[model samples]
Target: MTYADVFRAEWGQVVATLIRMIGDWELAEECTQEACAAALERWPRDGVPDKPGAWLTTTARNRAIDWLRREAVGAAKLQEVAAMTDEPPPAYDVPDDRLRLMFTCCHPALAMEARVALTLRTLAGLSTAEIARAFLVGETTMSKRLTRAKQKIQYAGIPYRVPPAHLLPERTPAVLAVLYLLFNEGYSDVSRSTLSQEGIRLARLLVELMPEEPEAAGLLALMLFHDSRRETRLSPDGVLITLDEQDRTRWNCELITEAEELLDRTLQRHMPGPYQVQAAIAACHAIARTAADTDWPQIAALYGQLPQTPVVALNRAVALGMADGPGVGLALVDQLATGSLAGYHLLPAARADFLRRLNRRTEAVAAYTEAIELATTDADRKYLQKRLVQVSVQS
Candidate 1:
């Protein structure tokens, strides 16, 4: 693999290991970056090492030890680092350094937003600017958020290891939520593909580490199901394609089959969670040969089982509209319009579709215009703009 690839794949593990060894987050990050830079300069000449991860770890740990020595930070920690250097790298195992790092970054003590941001920055190795752009915030804002989060971790004495067995049930949800958001952000905007893939990779690791956790498998299944349709999500001209309009032939059957298998395994456990419910909904869509064949009723029922967040309620309304009538969906949309979903683009977009289906051209046009104004992503904006033009002509 190229040096860049190695750095991307191993940076988090190296940092996590160094943090565990040296108990200094900043020092770990600094040493990891230096190790990566050294690899970039030396690998082309010395050739890639037999074990890139081990090589990087050794190099970074050595750097950390040197820094510790220079700082004169007591003999105890220095002795720890010196011993770490002497020991051979352990064999690859189920619960790797990255998984431990994920749990640590997603600690419940951190705010939910802080958990997501720190996971993306530390585990996924995304730049502050990249993360800022992904979340549609300014770079300065994201920088401060990350800095504050890291400071909190240090000052609050948050342990860097994975939670104990009793704590896993309570802690895993936050980690799963962070992964879900990371994948969603990437899925929504093609520019953030790395985040989506990183999310899947980490989710897979989580499942491997905790096979008894059905929700972990469910989360992975949900991501795989969504990823199966990635290629068909947009048209050649870069306009967003609704699920009904997408060419099903272009969908990745392999990923769909794998996701189904995962869902089946999780269902066998007889423990349904939000991720499992969402995965089942995705599976319902995947198994359908055409949009008309989709099990909207079943999907709606699945959504009903989920906690009624504004977004879930909005989605349920759309499914209800499809299964019942546009009027049913429109009534639900109207109820949400004055609530917390007032400014959400999808709420108006859903309203516009329901109105258009009911042949209320004037109302549809208005809703489409509102949706266009609030649309966030380029794809969403383009799709809404197209809908606006069509509805305007009809009006």
Candidate 2:
């Protein structure tokens, strides 16, 4: 990897380790930024270090210490360092600390929005503006949320350590949910800035750091299974392409194989968690040679057995429509439309597609128009517009 790439890759580790040592999330974040600035200035002539992660950490630590010394107010921080002066610095190689950082950022004491903003800023390397745009909010709002989150972390004395194994069952699911939210934020056009690439990258990181965690593995597999279709999910003109209409030949076979293997292994562990079940459903699609070959019945059955989340149910309904008919999918979509998802554009978007399939052009056109009106992002709006056009022309 190039130096820039290396810096980006090590950014989370550097920030995470500093947060552990400094016990101040905002200060650590600032120190990490300062360290990167210093690296940019010096690395060209000093050359990359043998262990860049350690180099960044030590450099950030020294910078923080120097600032504290100058201020003459960090007696406690200084004393803590002095007490540990003889000991070798803790290794940043364990890598699980980054995941721990995620848990810390998403701690329930903070508001959910704050957790998301802070997680994106600290762990995911997203800028405040980038995060604001993802959430369809103004930058100032996102900035305040992040600031409050960091302040809360400091005031609440939130420890930067992974929860214990006994506590894992209860807490780890929240961590998985955050990552899942992160993945979807990137996967969907609504929030994605990078080509679902960020989501895939983050999911891969989770699996790498927590290889034994079945949910992490399952989530990674699920992302890959769906991401393999990214190239064909949109047309050249950026219109949304339904799964059955997508060119299966363009799917990434290698990713499909890997996802299948991961799903198989996860299934054998005998842990029938939400992610594994979802991965199993995606696996049915991966195994299909052609759209016609997709075992819609099996997918529908898996959806029935899967845990009840609105998004999962929504997806299952879509699959059922494809597997069974628009009547089944429309029924589910209608229920969603009547309730919490009233403002959600995808509900209408999905309804439009199913309506079009059912030759209900007038209703399809109206649904597509509603989706376009509710769309938050330019890409999604454009996609909905195109759908509206197609249905209008058909009518």
Candidate 3:
């Protein structure tokens, strides 16, 4: 694999190892970046190392040892890092060091948003700006939050490992939230698709680690279902492709089947949670022979089972429109508390779609224009622009 490919595959493992050795989040990250950069520059000359992960861990740990010695923090820390081998010994039975780190980062003491943001930054190697955009916040704001979170971990001495089995029940929700947000960030942004893939990989690890946790299985199914369509979400020219317009023939059937079977297995446990419910909804779409065959009413019912957040409510409205008529959908969308969904581009985009369906061409054009303005990503903005042009012509 190329240096870039190797970086994506092993960044988390290398970071986890350094953190375990140095016990400094910032140092581990910085040294890991330096080690990866060294690889990028030197690999072409020296040839990619046969064991890039080992090479990276040695390079980064050595850097950390050097930094610690210069600062003279403690002989023990220097000795600890200096004596590290390629692999850091796990304190417990955690299968992967990265998973151990994720649980620590998602400690319940941190605000839910802070937990998700910190884990994304430390484990997935997302830049502060990238995490900020994912959270819909300014870069400076996210930077401060991350700083505070790490400080909290340091000062409070959050254990850098999986919680005890007794604590896992309470902490499981927060850990799941981190993975969900990480996956969502990846799913939304093409540039960071690797984050989504990493999220999936980690979720799989969680499922293995806790076989009885239905929600973990539920989450994995949800990710696989969503990722199955990744190839079709954007067109060749990079314009967004709506579900109905995507080519079913090219969808990843293997992923869909895996997700569906997993969801089925999890549902049999009879512990229905939001993730399972949402995965079931996704499965409805996946099983449809065509867009025309989608079970909108069933999907709408599944949406109703979820907590009625503004986004969920908006989606339910869309499903209602599809199941009933655009008029019903438009009415529900309009009935949402005004300003509750303010500045959420999808709200306007949903309105535009419902309006378009109702042949309210003038309203559709205006809504699409508004959505285009509010849209954050280029693909979304382009898709709205296309819709605006179509509706404008119709009007």
lDDT of 3: 0.84
C-alpha lDDT values of all predictions: 0.84, 0.75, 0.84
Any idea how many clashes model 3 has?
Answer: 0
TM-score, model 1 to reference = 0.75
Give the higher-TM-score candidate: 1 or 3.
3
| Candidate 2 clashes between residue pairs 3 or more apart in a chain or in different chains | none
Q: Cα deviation of 141 in candidate 2 (Å)? A: 9.7
lDDT of candidate 1 vs native? 0.84
lDDT per residue for candidate 2 within 237-335, as digits (tens), equals 766676777888999999998998888887788676778888888888878888889998888888888776666678788888887799989988888
In model 2, the runs with Cα more than 4 Å from the true position are 1-18, 26-73, 78-89, 103-117, 126-152, 162-171, 189-212, 376-378
Error of 3 at 391 (Å): 2.6
lDDT of 3 by residue, 77-119 (tens): 7877788876456576557677777776678888888888887
Full ranking by lDDT: 3, 1, 2
276, model 1: CA deviation in Å? 0.8
RMSD of each: 4.7, 5.3, 3.0
